[model samples]
Target: MAILVLSVLVLLLSLYFRLKKRQKNDGLNKFPEGPSHPLLGHLPLMTSTTDVIDVSMQLIRNHGKTVKIRIGPKILPMRTSLLTADSHLTEFILSGNKILKKTENYQFLKHWLRKGLLISDGDYWKRHRKILTPAFHLEVLKEFVQVFESVGDVLIEKLRRCEGTPSCDLHPFVTLCTLDVICETAMGTKMNVQSGKNSHYVQSVKKTCRIIIERSMSTLKLTDTTFWLCRDFYTLKNELKVLHDFTHNVINSKKNNKSIDKNTKRLAFLDLLLKFSQDENILSTDEIREEVDTFMFAGHDTTASGICFTLYCLADHPEVQKQALQEQKDLFGDEKNPVITYPDLQNMKYLEQVIKESCRLYPPVPIIGRYTTEDTEFDGCLIPKYTNIMLFIYGLHRDPDYFPEPEKFKPERFDNFDGSLSYTYIPFSAGSRSCIGQKFAMLEMKSIISKIVRHFEIKPTSPRHEVKLSAETVLKSLNGIKVTLKKRP
Candidate 1:
């Protein structure tokens, strides 16, 4: 009798779920239409990694500017929102508005990220942003130029060692270059991961991203009990535990050591954060760790991806390469080149255009996700609450309307526009959530490109070395991006 009762109850609950799910889909027809599947809803559309950006673009193309997508079970009520390339809607979402909140998918990041700026929302995000903004200021970045120059020179020498090689994987080199910068700039310590054996830190960072991307692809259907019981999840937990121990020990060592003067000439980001930790008006020690970790994650890979794309663009487009080379010659000709001054970088408008163009073609973070907290209307379509919203910058950048001949590599498009369409060409994103390190990132990219183009001419070993992109948090090549680096006289 007891078994019979439980079976009937389970059947009743399943029936209720099917009915509720049907109602949600029926409601979506009243708004913009999107591809849907029974039981799965629009979940199947984004299952593949390669076409996620393309899929988003297709949605926009099929359903106009604003579209509604149903994701997961209807009982969850998480509606996926896409705002197309509508500038007003873009501004609205990124403006840090109260009504539009980060979705619950971000909750998954809390496992690794905690309350860092990237994961925080509302008051916590604002408070941290205020305290952290000072570190990336113009004056502070100016101090890092010497370090940038030194690193650039070292990297050039490293590439010189590979001079005769017909082809090389440039991605690893770019990753090393940026890793060196972040270690110096963020940690005040130098860990040259570029040419040397991979450090524990570098490997750990890559591993974490790979796992996170893999986990993101699957549906989080396991119950807490099931997860606790699972062996695979246990292994993941232990790996993360190791990473946590490593980061914590590094922070603790720096804190306890009194050998280095607080007034040391090198104002590394770690030093700055340490200073903040001491001040009464600033962040607590726990907060300091979160912010430092945030910078550590943010500083390296995104910039590396940007630089890699820039080099690929230059190598692929000879005319653009020629133009960039001329610009470097005109700006800093002859004389085994002085370090790129802030002024020199600022003046290299054409190089800036080239980087922007590369970013358009290959954005580092191809998709930025947000979750809606409340029911919202976007372009006359009802976006139900808890939806995962994806702003597909990759698709938007490639849209023919915004960028004609979008597939062609052309830096000149930026030359015609007077930098007004910042939101339109948001390689670093725009509005309140704009990358805090934009100024620093630009300086590093410009300085590196200036040094590189001036010294060597890059080319592909085979024009047939098909360029491809994959995502492990940041978009990168499936295999490393290999190309020929020819020495220039």
Candidate 2:
């Protein structure tokens, strides 16, 4: 009787897999196939590998640009995604208004960022985008240049401590500096993160980011119930409380404070939101917190990643660094620490090229996700509704057709380049849903990078460290971004 029961179970399991395989084949027949398991789909491929980015690149090379990857277990109602590095498909997806909803993976951020611009969709996203658009305008960004210069000064002083060291990991120092910049410019609150005054806030932010990434990757922690049972969930809960409390405190302080003269003080992004809240009454206090928190999250980490990678590239390539330094020297001749005004930042054209090239090689946000809201056709291939789409920005930037000799770091390639095209290089992404703070981010990066190049002669370590790139919430190096610095005389 026991043998008979076991035989029946085996037969049922076999039948289940067979049915699932057939359905998968029928559903994704139009798209190119990627390496996948019979029962687990592509989950095993991603989970088993430590080099996720490299593995993904290889998969794209083996398969076509647009390949269908099945996710989760076959026994359950799993997700099907079209992972595309194809520029045309990327343009089709990103340039369209019909598919603005983010994929389910972004749900992990909702607990922390709430329904801010990064995760919000439809009318809410549109409304918030409109309200926040003016905050990144030329006049507003010009006002923030002084903030960047002050933050850059702090960064230079911090790095000066490590000047004589054989090598130093710049990631931590750069991260803290960007954190300070975002807090001051976005919230009108000085976090003093660089000085270690708000260690709890900094740690909480880092912990929350790690938890979100881990939760997104873990199949076991994907569901709310399962996540609630995990140890990480508890840690994340505590960290989120710390983060939310900080944002709320800032909001409360801003609301009650009335001593500031509006004309003399530069308005922050938070100030703008408050003005909107008071005048139009379109945003609640919680909504204001959400936007502020969103800016804090989006603004800092991504820019830090960009700055670190650019510095690494500069250290690795001496000639490129020399050219960039020469441009800076030409601009601020004989001035050791010239004030980095908006025009000075704008005039550092070669430095801009170097930054752009580094971004091409290592985009901060390597992959961005969107889901189809309706059945869509791309290049004669029909995509069913509710399908997730992973736009491989890393792969798009490396497409040799658009960027010749893609592996080589050639800043000159961008001398006369037009990156405005939706399908081409999009480190900050493109189209209607593109990063609103692109201008602000670029200005900040230019200000910071130019300052570093002007004040220090950056060089690679004696052994030369190779960054092991990891595709996290943002692009990060598993090994630190190591470089040696000699203060310019």
Candidate 3:
């Protein structure tokens, strides 16, 4: 089987190279300005630093909105990518159903998540999504509000300990709290990350994410053989086992048991999948595990980054934080330990705008990619079937065309904002392939952020320019998001 797989891979490479050679010979036009090396092309440009998010953003400014980039080693011509900074072109690519298959790099995730919705394409993706869409529906997501607010209170209590501190790093607290929420919501298992007992589980998940990212950014490890030869490869496999076992154990615990409680009226994400396993489109154990992993990772990192950055924005703009607190105060007047209902979340309109602006300034996923399934034409250039289109979410959000003075945090941009940025401002991406968990993410972020801002006054030490960003599936601050906290008196 290995021999056959290798043989087929060699044949595919030959065919790909032949097609690319023909296109090169046609000699359409010039490539975008980038540090193209003699043999490595643009590989060295990004591989030199872990800060690819900032690097890619700067490249768009220097090389123009539509920039040509290259990744991977010298051998694979398929490593070349087009960085689309224009919102129209970005919309065009993400909006199309026929061309939305994620690039090959996403396959690297199968070790951790398997062929779940985040990576799978074609019929399988569509079918699985159909089964899972109801899990995130408005009514169903309402069921998880108690879960969100429960974790939110835990996070607030954790932050309360750091009150009156000179400066505190909020990301770690936010990450652990969100991790616990996802585990309970998806796996039906309480990970207790907020209490610090299950720090190992959190580390395993983070380590797995880091390994996947390091593999993507490494020029040598871009190829299967090169990655397999490295010591880190073994580390990734070992970490994968910890995470896989953690998730598998959850499934085993709930396989035969149908326990209902006072809080949960219906089955949660993983519970629903298991509940549906006896139907016509029965999900296998492997399928259930894949979906659980997909939701578990999605539910944890994206919202954590978002809430952290929203706090960063609040810390940066004191006036905005004041307004948010005022809004919260209006909702729950002098009632300490107030219940944050779903209706309260909806009424916090100004806070919602603040979250939108925060997402614009520091999006969770910096860059999203898709490979053309067939020859596609855009901006009067023919994009070959296998070419990589790196949609710069960071760049698109900050583009001057859609957003004037995009650098500044202006929550007013979304004030009475009639969803004009349907294509332009894609914090959760756009079109059919957009994140299904966006509502769930928003609920979690707003819940915790509202709680945090209400309890503590965040004071940012580092300005926006000082905090460095990197693309790690989720956007992260290299210098770390530093802020001082004072309990609201």
Clashing pairs in 3: none
Could you tell which candidate, 1 or 3, scores higher by lDDT?
3
lDDT value, candidate 3, whole model = 0.81
Superior candidate under TM-score, 2 versus 3: 2
lDDT against the true structure, per candidate, is 0.75, 0.88, 0.81
Better of 2 and 3 by lDDT: 2
Among all candidates shown, the one with the greatest lDDT: 2
- Rank by lDDT (best first): 2, 3, 1
What 10-residue stretch in candidate 2 is worst by lDDT? 71-80
C-alpha lDDT (0 to 100) for residue 181 of candidate 2? 95
Q: Compute the lDDT for candidate 1.
A: 0.75
Candidate 1 residue-wise lDDT, 376-470, digit = tens: 77556565665666676787788787789999999988888876655667777777777899889989988887888878888877654666677
Clashes of each: 2, 0, 0
lDDT of 3 by residue, 221-287 (tens): 7777798888878888888888888788888778755664424564678878876775555799889
Backbone-clash count (model 2): 0
What TM-scores do the predictions have? 0.89, 0.94, 0.91
